[model samples]
Target: MAGSAHGDIPLTTISFSQRPNGTVATVTVSNPRKLNSLNTTVLDAFLSCVPPLAQRSDLRCVIVTGGLCSVGQQAFIGGADISEMKDFSNAEAGRTFINKLHLACKALRNLPVPVIARVNGHALGGGLVVMASADLRIATSDARFGMPEVQRGVPSTIEAAMLPAQIGAARARRLLLLGDTISAQEAESWGLVDKVVQADQLDEAVEEWVDRLLKNGPRALRIQKKLFAMWEQVPLREAIEAGVWEFGTPFEAEGFEAEGRRMMNEFQMQNRQRKSRL
Candidate 1:
């Protein structure tokens, strides 16, 4: 449980812990002063911490969550630190600041394995965009979500564009344009969050997702995730063609064909035994 500092940014900490089985990694974000907000310093630390985890050979899934609140409540990311935005006087400076945030989000999305947002508290503005970028999201019932950037005099950009694909254009507009925060149930109903549970059940819910993802073939899962991202940008016919290409990629990987043949043989054997028993 010993944590290390990222460079000299002691207040902003990113910790990673691998499960005993080595299939899952849990990344905890802690910045107690701002409810785990992503300031420039924190964005740097996050960019440094995530890319290596994404490249791990043994990793199958990732659970990203914020540090715990004092009362033992799970404090998921609050959003980008507004305090840091107050002094921005030029377009170039603003662009530089936003690019760092984009890099952090890109690292999470680029992970070959599924990245699950374990949302246990408020996820606003850029925080909501981070949740949107995850392959899957599970949240506590009390978790709140919004795109409040408009209220702060800034438009939600970067991965925030993923909102429409996540919750449909209409619902994405409600949050992005109106700056409305939705309850966890509402988020699920809108298809923003995949699952919602009680606060105490959050960890169990996340484990369930990790277990389910781990059950899939790792190469197939990686291909599927890659295609899913590609689908967002490509035309329908091209996307279908990409899927066909990915379908054949597993066979190109050594031993995949042999494994598939073995599994099919086992399935056929089981069917024959069942018929004989009948």
Candidate 2:
């Protein structure tokens, strides 16, 4: 948000960009000097920034990225600013810091549209959880992942709780207890990441996901994401009922039904044309 007092350079920035069509957006965290680490300022930027993106009615997908460094380090988010936290003198301050971190992650998770984490670098500690908060993650082959807070004299908590469900308990334990970073390949095998590619191919991989998402029904995609969040929190029976209710949602009160009708008619006409050609 705000830069240094002298205005020579920005201290940290969470910048947002949208496609010309306004259906896709990118949120880039730029603190390259710190490998995009989350300081209070950076965390505050996330808190203030995500809501505006989430509220966009035209947005079908959001891609989150970590800015690249001059030295070619792919640090998505190295962690909370350890240098900034080393001076914490009170329990209240520690709690406040952690609360900010949790809120930032929750903001990403709360987006109605899919959040694709285009992780090009290290997603360690808090960064890993932020990456997890995304609906899907596409990391570079050299990306690193772990929870090294244990090494810094603190247990990994908060959204670190999500690791077990994402990567299974054994793998999650290996990360938290051992404080060792895993390669992107290992992370993909463990189900922590959806896909991994070379640094040069990272943008292509992300665009592929975005293009695929754009082909689907926009309203259905949003409803599906909402149901996904519901399914994660509720019992199987309730989740099923929620889906049942949503099954007829597009055809119900809102103008979403018009989209459904239009697409169905287009598909049927295309199918008829194909049959006649045969």
Candidate 3:
């Protein structure tokens, strides 16, 4: 894929490759000196990178993670770059800074395919908010998560507000109020992360999810993801009605109908052959 960085920000990178006959794009955050902090530059790079990837019809999934670090290092993203925040002397400056981060997060969430967060280490404050924006997250056992923005004298905002829908209001409140980090296990239990694996298995877990997603019909997956986003915005009854309408959409679309029938026939044929053999 074309490079993601714009201007002098060389820390962020987007690598694209074919996997299971579909495109898989990875966005790596690589500011090791600052523990992969999400500075305005990096967030700007992310915003530029993700939209093009999202628009690709062949793209199946996007994986966001920190670039490789030393064996025992800790940080997917330590947080927003404090140095950048220190100069936020006015409400407008603070809004501008946070808005940049929000745009990055929004770009990720708007991707047509699933976005998977591969959380290898620390994901604190804005880092944690970024992780929450992903459609799914798989983290290493040693990974840490928290919303410590409050500790830094700023309440978590934008995608950080997504925590209530992710891990529940009570748990989200605890993290936002206390600014305490939680282990990967606790994060999984609280529904912040979908799975936790050994550090060595982090890539394997991500690959497994990617493979699972790839196995489904692309159009169906896209529609499902869109419906998921819609559910978040609508009331329960309206959401259910929308979902039912979505369920019948494939049949209304000729290509999806043909593919679904073909798959069903293959499945029935396999079952019949097995029964006859028995």
Candidate 4:
């Protein structure tokens, strides 16, 4: 993983492989050779990759990152290849482009299990939007994030409906209105990212995150995750009522309390056994 200066930018490409454990799927945005720009071809490849991997019951987490040697030199995705946009003219063309972008984002959002963005480098403009679709995101200290579409004479389209909820109005406005890049640390502060670690430590950190996530029961995690998602659309009171009726009432009236009692008793018995062994 040498630095990008050694004619490695074209090495910027995307690939996905499942780990031997079959629990985590790793998607690499290579082209540490080209900085992994998301042109139409790359986007099509990425969209194709996401669906099948997402359907796997064996998968608990997905780790997305850049190729080795990808550091401060280039972004995880630089942006849509500007050269590819030369033919855009009519409203229909613009709508089609935006539709593709929206579907790509939606695919990630709709993934049943968690997706972790192991951002290995800069993620600007459309790149940042792509990163934002992940459920959890860990950025390296050298990672850069922004939405500089305005700088390119384009409006921030797909994110027009999503960012405000994740980051709140003020922070979203600052990023979207200005179309500026922010340090990984700053992104964490604004609630756009989870944490920033040393560049060399990103892979280990992502694995650690997945380890923690795997400790939870899959069904419980799915229910709770959807619970949080439902909170966004309905009003607070209505959400609370719906949660009480749909989730809380069923669980509370079901085996949860009994399970808690049983678990506590089992834990006490285990403690006694350990003491006797001592």
Pick out the ten consecutive residues of candidate 4 with the lowest summed lDDT.
Answer: 1-10
Q: Write the per-residue lDDT of candidate 1 for residues 1-278, one digit (tens) a residue.
A: 22454432323344455555457777766666577777887777677778887677888888777775444344588888888888888998899999888887898899988899999798887778777878899999998889888898889899988888777899888998999998999999999989999988988988887877776667767788899889988999999998887777656635526444554567899999999999
Whole-model lDDT per candidate: 0.78, 0.83, 0.84, 0.70
lDDT of 4 at 77: 68
Best-fitting candidate, scored by lDDT? 3
Structural similarity to truth (TM-score) of each candidate: 0.88, 0.91, 0.92, 0.79
**What residue runs in model 2 are displaced by over 4 Å at the alpha carbon?**
1-21, 70-72, 253-257
Determine the backbone clash count of candidate 2.
Answer: 1
Clashes of each: 0, 1, 0, 14
Can you write out model 2's per-residue Cα lDDT over 188-253, one digit (the tens) per residue?
Answer: 999999999999999899998888888888888999999999988999999999999998777764
RMSD of 1: 3.2
What's the C-alpha lDDT at position 124 in model 3?
Answer: 88
Write the number of the candidate with greater TM-score, choosing between 2 and 3.
3
Residue lDDT tens for model 3, 72-128: 576888889999899889999989999998988898889999899999898988888
